[model samples]
Target chain A: GAGVSQTPSNKVTEKGKYVELRCDPISGHTALYWYRQSLGQGPEFLIYFQGTGAADDSGLPNDRFFAVRPEGSVSTLKIQRTERGDSAVYLCASSRTSGIPDTQYFGPGTRLTVL
Target chain B: DQQVKQNSPSLSVQEGRISILNCDYTNSMFDYFLWYKKYPAEGPTFLISISSIKDKNEDGRFTVFLNKSAKHLSLHIVPSQPGDSAVYFCAASAQGSGTYKYIFGTGTRLKVLA
Candidate 1:
C-alpha cells in the first residue's frame, strides 16, 4: 500500500514488560510523528522526528517512552516497564515537510494492551 | 490544560440532512486549523483545513468556518451521507513553530443515519 504501514496491528503484554512498535512511512516523507489515543480521546503527540533527529519530544509521558528514526524512513517506538495506562492505540504519521500548511498522513494504529 | 476542546461527544443526523460539528480552542497562538475523519481501527484522514486569515473554506459538500475572535470553528456537511458517519477531530497549529506541532481536540462522533 502507498500509505503508512505499522507492524503488529495489535499487541498484548503484561505490565512491567517492554514492547516495540514499528512504523514505515510513505516513500520520501521527511517528518515522522508518534501519537497515542486512549478511549474517548484524540491522538496526543508523543514525539516527532525530523530526519534522523528528534525535533520535539515534549509530549512523551515519561522517560520510559522513547522513539527513534535512525534512517528517517522507518521509525520505532519503544516502551519500557509498561503500565495498564499505556494501553491505547499507538498511531504513526508522516508528512512531506514540517513547515506551514503541514498535513500529516497516518497509519492504521497498533493497539497496545498492557495488562 | 486542553488547548482544543470538542464538547459534544457524539451527534446523529439523518441522511440528506445537514450536519454540523463544532470545536473551540483556548490557545491564541493557533493560526491554522484542520479537520480529520477516522473510521474504526483506521487512521485519521485529513478532510479540510482553514487558515486564520480566512473566515470560511469550502470543498464539495463540506465547509469549515473559522471565527478567530471567538476562538471557535465548525465543520458543516450538507446532505449528509451514511458513509460520512465517523469520528471527527479538530486540530490546530501555530505559525512560527517549524514543525507546526498540532494540538487536537477530543473528537466528536457523527452518525449519519440512513
Candidate 2:
C-alpha cells in the first residue's frame, strides 16, 4: 500500500528483446534507487535518482540498461538487448533524500527471466 | 570489487538466546553502516544503523555496532525469536553523497530455532 511498489512482479523475455520494469515510490519519497540481486548474493546498485535526475548510474552494467523517473515519484527501468545474465530480481527502494542516508523502504522486486 | 563482506553465510541460534552476526569491510571512507532483514520473496526491511563516530546504536530488540578502526561491524539480537529467522544484510555508505550508493554484503541467513 504505502510502501514502494514494483509492477510486473515477474517478467519473462527472449534474449535480445526489450523490457521495461516499473517502480512506484512512496508518496513523499524523493530519492529512488534500483538494485539487481543474483541468486545467493547481495543486491548491487544499478542506478540512483534524486528527484527526476539520475545522480549516478555507474553501477549500470552496460549501455543496454537505462532508467528514468519522469515525475520523480514513479520510475521505470528499461533494458535493451536483454541477455540471460541480465536475469535477476530487480529491486526498487525509496528514501527521504539521497543525502539523508537513513532508512530506505524497498519493494517486493520484479523477477526478470531471460531466455 | 566487493567492499563489504559477511564472512559467514549462515548462523543458527536457539530461541530466547542471543544471536550475533558479523560483517567486515575493506573501505575506510565508509561513514555509516546499516543492517537489513529479508524474508522469502519479500524485500529487505531496515533493522538498525550506526554511524562510524558511534560505537553502537540500539533499537528495541536490535543493536548495531561499528568498529571503524577494524573495519568491522556486528548486529546483535537479544532473546532471538523464530521471527528473526531471515537473511541479514550489512551495508555501508561512503560519505553518502552524489550517487549515494550503499554497498552491501552477501548476507547471512540467521535461523532462530524455536
Candidate 3:
C-alpha cells in the first residue's frame, strides 16, 4: 500500500511570498495532520483534520498558517507572507481514525526554504 | 515549554550491544507514548509504543518501558545493528483528554557502530 505522499519535496520562496504544500493521505484514513520541523528540533504540530472538518488547529503558530481537507483525503497547507523564520521541513501524517491509539503514518516531508 | 524532552542529543553503541534512548514528559495527562525512527530526508517511521497502563511493551528486538510515576520512558534495542542508526523521537499524546495531537521531543541521534 502507498504511504502518505507530499508534493513539491522541496520549495524555495522569498520572504513575503505565499506557498502551499499538498498532502495525500493513505487511502481510507479518516484523520490527517500537519507538522513543521525546525533545524535540530522535533516536529511541531500544526493542525489536524478528522474527515472534512478540522478537529484541532491550536498548534497553528499564527494567522498566516491555514490548512484544509475538503474531500477528506487530500489536504493543503497554506502559508501567507513567508518568513525566514518559517524555513523548515513541513510533514504530513495520517491514521485510520482520530482520538484513538492508532499509529500515525508519515510522509516524506517537504523542505521549505525562505530566503 | 517542551512537554516532551529527549535529554540526550546523541548516543553511540557498539554492534550486538544494547541501545537505550530515554525521554521525559512534563504533562502528566499524557497516557500514550510512541517511538519513531527517522533517516535523513525521510519521514519518521513508527517503532514501538507503550501505554501508561503498562510498565513495559516488547516487540522483537525493540522494547519500550514506561515509568508513569517518574514521567519518563525508555526505548531499548538489543543487539543493536548498524542499520538501526538514525534519529529517534518520542511522542506523547493524551488520548482521553479529547486532544488527538501529539507532542514530540527534540529527538535523539543514535549511532550503532559495527
Candidate 4:
C-alpha cells in the first residue's frame, strides 16, 4: 500500500465484547505502532513493534488489551472484555526504521465505540 | 499526567498574517519534536519537525523552532491562509534510538479567517 492501512474504520460493540482491529503497514517498513485517543485528547501510546516481536507493550491499559504482529509487515490489536472506557480511536503507524527518530506515517484509525 | 502540553486550545488568525502555535514538554529525554495538521474526519498529516539538537528548521512557509533548555517548541506559518485552518498536534518521543511511541499534546485548533 502507498500508506498505512487500517481495517474497519469504525466499530461499535457492547461492553464485554471482543474486537479485533487490523493494520497493514507500508511495504518494507520495519517498525509499527498502535495508539489510542480518547475524546478531546491526543493519541496515547499503546504498543510498538520492532519487527515480528513487540518491542514495547507497557503502554497497553491492561492485559485485556493485547496486540500482535506475527509478520513484520502487518499487525493486529485485539481488545477483550471491552469496557465502555475502552471506547476511543485506535491508530496505527509505520516507519521505515524501527525506533524513535524515524518519521511515522499514520492510518485513518478505527474509531471503536463501546456501548 | 500529560507529558506534552499545548495550553492554547484555539487560535484565530487573519488571512495573510502569521500564525504561531506553541507547545511545551516536561520530559527532557525527548530527542525530537514534530507537528501534524489534521482536518475533519481525516488523519493527521506531518508538517514539520525539529531535532532537539537544533533550535530551528524551515520548510517553505512552515518553520519549527525548538528550545531544549526551556522544553518548549513553536511552529510558525508565514502568511497564514484559510486553507491552513486545522487542528495542529505537537508530539515528542523519548529514547529515539528504540521506539517511536510518541507523547502528543492536546491539539490546538487554529482558524485562519479571510
Candidate 5:
C-alpha cells in the first residue's frame, strides 16, 4: 500500500509571505498530524486532526499557523506571514486511529525555506 | 526545555555487532515510548515501542528497554547491518493521561559498517 505523501517537497519563499504544505494520508486513516523539524533538532508537534475536526492544536507555535482536514483524508498546513524562524521540514503522519499503541505512518515531508 | 533527549549525536558499529541507543526524558507523565528510524530526506518510520508497564519489548533483532523509575529507555539492535544505518528518534507520549501528541528527541545517527 502507498504510504503517506506530501506535495511540493521543497518550497522557498520570502519572509512575511504565506505558504501551504499538503499531506495525503494513507487510505482509511482517521487521524492526521503535522510536525515541524528544525536543523539539528527533532520534530516538534504542530497540530492534529481526528476525522475532519482538529482534535488538538496546542502544538501550533502561534496564531500564524493553522491546519485543516476538510474531507478527512488530505490535510493542509498553512503558515501566515512566515518568518525566517519558521523555516524547517514540515512532516505529516497518520494512523488508523488516535488510540494507544497505534503506529503512525509518515510522509516524506515538505521542506520550507523562508528567505 | 527538551522533554526527551538523545545524548549521543552519532554512533558507529561493525556489521553483526550490537548497537545500542539511549534516550532520557524529564517528564514522568510519559507512559508510551517509541523508536523511529529516518533516512535522509524522509520522515521518520516507526521501528519499535514499549509501554511503561513493561520493562522490555523485543521484535526480531530490535529490542526496546524501558525504565520508568529512571525516566529512560534504550533501543538495542543485534547483528546490525548497513541497512540499519540511519537517524533514530525516541518519542514519548502520555497516552494514559489523555495526551496523544508525542515529544521526540533530537535523534541519534547510526552508521553500520559492513
Candidate 6:
C-alpha cells in the first residue's frame, strides 16, 4: 500500500521567489492535511481538506500561503514571495475517515530552503 | 500560543529500562491526546493515544497515561529498545461543533542506549 508522498523531497529557492509543493495521498483517503516543521520544532498545522474542498485553512500563516485540492486525492501548497523565515520541511498527511479519532498517516516531508 | 508543551527537549535511557516522556497542555477543551515518533528526514509515525475520559491505555510495551486534572500526559515504554529512539511529539485535539484540530508540542528527542 502506498503511503502519502510528497514530491521534490528537497527544494532550494531564493527569497522573494515562488514555489509549489505537491502531495499525493494514499489510495481511498478522503481526508488530507498539510503541516510545516521548523528546526527543533514539531509540525504546525497548515490546512485540512475533506474531499474536494478545504475544511479548514486557519493554520495558514498569511496571504503568501495557499493550498488547493481539486480532485480530493492530490494537493498542492503554493507559496509566493518566499522569505528566509519560510525555510522548513513541509509535511502532508491523510486519513481514511474524517474526525478526531482517525489516525493520520504522514509522508516523508519536503525540505524547502530559502537561500 | 503553544497549547501543548514538552518541557524536556531530550531524554536518554538504557535498553531494558523504562522510558518516560512527559507532556502538558493548557487547553482544557482537549479531550484526546496522541503520541508520535519521528526519525531524521522522515514524517512522524503514530505511536499510541489516550482519551481524557480514561486515565491510561496500554498497547504492548507502550502505555499512555493521562491526568486531566493536571492537564498532563505521559508515554511510558517498558524495556525500551534502541529502535524506539526518536523524536516524540505530543498532540492534543478537541472535538466540538463538528470541528476538530490537533495542536502539537515542540517534541522531545529520545535516545535509547544499548
Task: Return the top candidate by TM-score.
Answer: 3
Candidate 3 lDDT, B15-107, residue by residue in tens? 999999999999999998999999999999999998788999999999999999999999999989999999999999998787878899999
Which lDDT tens digits does candidate 1 get at residues A1-115? 8999999999999999999999999899899999999999999999998999999999999999999999889999999999999999999999998877778889999999999
Model 3, span A1-115: residue lDDT tens: 5899999999999999999999999999999999999999999999999999999999999999999999998999999999999999999999999756767889999999999
Best DockQ among the predictions, by candidate number = 3
Worst 10 residues of 1 chain A by lDDT: A97-106
lDDT tens per residue, model 4, A1-115 = 5998899999999999999999999899988999998878888989999899898888998999989898788899999999999998898998888544688888989999999
TM-score of each: 0.97, 0.97, 0.98, 0.97, 0.97, 0.97
Instruction: Give the higher-TM-score candidate: 3 or 5.
Output: 3
Q: Pick by lDDT: which candidate is best? A: 3
lDDT of 5 by residue, B57-113 (tens): 999999999988888899999989999999999999988887778899999999999
lDDT of 1: 0.94
**lDDT of the structure predicted as candidate 4:** 0.90
lDDT of 6 by residue, B1-114 (tens): 889999999999999999999999998988888999999999999899887779999999999999999999999999899999999999988854344557899999999999
Please, what are the lDDT tens digits per residue for candidate 2 over residues B16-111? 999999999998888888899999898889888887879999999888888888899999999899999999999888755443778999999999
Candidate 4: which pairs clash? none
State, as a TM-score between 0 and 1, how close model 4 is to the true structure: 0.97
For every prediction, compared with the true complex, DockQ reads: 0.78, 0.73, 0.83, 0.70, 0.80, 0.70
Better of 2 and 4 by DockQ: 2
Candidate 5 lDDT over residue span A1-115, tens digit each: 4899999999999999999999999999999999999998999998989999999999999999999999999999999999999999999999899888666778999999999
Model 1 ranges with Cα > 4 A deviation: none
What fnat does each of the candidate structures reach?
A: 0.73, 0.71, 0.82, 0.67, 0.71, 0.67
Report lDDT (CA) for all predictions.
Answer: 0.94, 0.92, 0.95, 0.90, 0.94, 0.92
Checking candidate 3 for backbone clashes, the offending pairs are none
The order by descending DockQ is 3, 5, 1, 2, 6, 4
Instruction: State in Å the error of residue A14, model 6.
Output: 1.1
- Better candidate by DockQ, 5 or 6: 5
TM-scores computed on chain B for all candidates: 0.97, 0.95, 0.99, 0.97, 0.98, 0.96
